[model samples]
Target: MDSSSAIHGYVAEFEKAEQLVAATRRTRLAGYRVFDAYSPFPVHGLDEAMGHPRTILPWLVFLGGLAGGVGGYLLQYYPHVIDYPLNVGGRPLNSWPSFIPVTFEMTILGAALVAVFGMIILNGLPQHYHPIFNLERFERASQDRFFLCIETKDPKFNKTETREFLLELGASEVSECEE
Candidate 1:
């Protein structure tokens, strides 16, 4: 431990996806909540091992689509019925059937847009910096390496003990992250 700097966490490198998953499960069982696992590609059952809950993205998208549909309907209704009444081709000014296509398109647009933005925001995207990025070999994370990090903020974090625990899990190497 350095006196001038603060420790952010400890990162452990694993050789295989299975190894990472097993280590993650062990870590979770060991009562460490402030931890994360990283893999080059998606690994099955990793979320279950990490004990992450289901997301509310589906509900958010549904509400966004509903709002868009209602707004679309009102936009056309107000203009053709209330703002300036127009009886085109003997059809009523408040003809809701004619507004269906536009409303449907707007609904799709709203849902898609909300999904894109919501995922980005929810996942904390556009983050250009993190303490993990300070690791020299961390760039391999996007290539072939797998990593599991136990943050210092964890209630049960003990730097020396955590390092030894990761080594016991067969980590290829363990690095300390400082911020």
Candidate 2:
């Protein structure tokens, strides 16, 4: 297929989130890559059931904070002491106590920024369109429905076979999802 030619896959629509969740669990257990899921609200245990790996956002935040803390301390220290030494209250150059508060604040700010940006990138947000959104009934996703989309890129995805598999897994309705 041409690189510009999108390989469309079928979508199995469900009336309830529970049905979709259960189907996703089975599909993952069968070793299929799930493209995404849509739910009205957060569903407890759904991520675990889908076998989603743990997120690295926390680690990224920590590293960012560490770098910020070091940077803030160095910026203050280099300017106040090394670049132009200033004697005040007989305090020694490179005073550790004076730098603590500013360092702490900078660390928190950096971590917060990193956390926000990391989450956005990791979650792939700001998407204007999706194949699943093309389905007529998918408008209920933000209301009372849940959806699981297994992409055509999945190794085991055969149009006919996947539909049959979804149906057997108790999908309320299965319809083709196109992009």
The lDDT of each candidate is 0.90, 0.80
80-172, model 1: which lDDT tens digit per residue?
A: 989999777997888889899999998998888898899999989989888888888889999999999999888888878999999999999
- What is the number of residue pairs that collide in model 1? 0
Question: In model 2, which residue pairs have backbone atoms overlapping below 3 Å?
Answer: none
As a whole number from 0 to 100, the lDDT of residue 40 in candidate 2 is 88
Per-candidate TM-score against the hidden true structure: 0.93, 0.85
Residue 124 error, candidate 1, Å: 1.7
Tens digits of per-residue lDDT, candidate 2, 1-179, equal: 34313645666667776777788788888878845667889987789778777999999999999998999899899998899988898989889898999999999988999999999989888777666777888898898777777778887777778889878887677777766
**Which ten contiguous residues of candidate 2 have the minimum total lDDT?**
1-10
Where does candidate 1 have its weakest 10-residue lDDT segment? 1-10
Best-performing candidate as measured by lDDT:
1
